[model samples]
Target: MESIKASLPDVIQQRIEDLVNAQTTDEEMAAHIKELGCRIAALEALAPEEKGEEAGQLGEAVHRLCERIRRDYVAIAYRQGLVDGMRMDKLAAEE
Candidate 1:
């Protein structure tokens, strides 16, 4: 695992540190993401339609941010699952 990680890019290393190492469960993350989406929608709703393209751009940018976060989380979950599976396999072998 260390060898595999060492070969990856520095950005991925940061992601593992920032996300995969977190103690949060998948459900908690999903809920948090849902909340963020709701907040985004609420903020967009508050923007005056008369303000025109700027408000739309802001909403689109925020939405993209959320989507990026969600995508990272999917990668995090997959890596975590792989680690969990490795642990289980090790335990089974020991038995």
Candidate 2:
């Protein structure tokens, strides 16, 4: 969680704010996940399969890092759905 904050505190903060302030539905989260998958695919395509190249290795590392972030976002979005389903949002609010 600290690593995530260090990397994208703004994004995470904005997402949480959005979830709390608006009707962020599960459908929207699913679409974001699908879009991330498409973006990852395109990124992987740009990094050729050849080995021993420093750039490709760096790109692969970055790809994995991005995948991790995307997974975290998915979890966040799913939890938002759960909170809404339970009506927990009513108990929580941002000032």
Off by over 4 Å in 2: 1-52, 88-95
Tens-digit per-residue lDDT, 58-84, candidate 2: 656766786687678779878876755
**Top candidate when judged by TM-score against the true structure:** 1
Query: lDDT of each model, Cα atoms only?
Result: 0.69, 0.61
**Per-residue alpha-carbon lDDT of candidate 1 for residues 57-94, written as tens digits (9 for 90 to 100):** 77679878877977897787789768756755665555
Model 2 Cα displacement at 12 (Å)? 22
Clashes of 1: 0
> Against the true structure, candidate 1 has what lDDT?
0.69
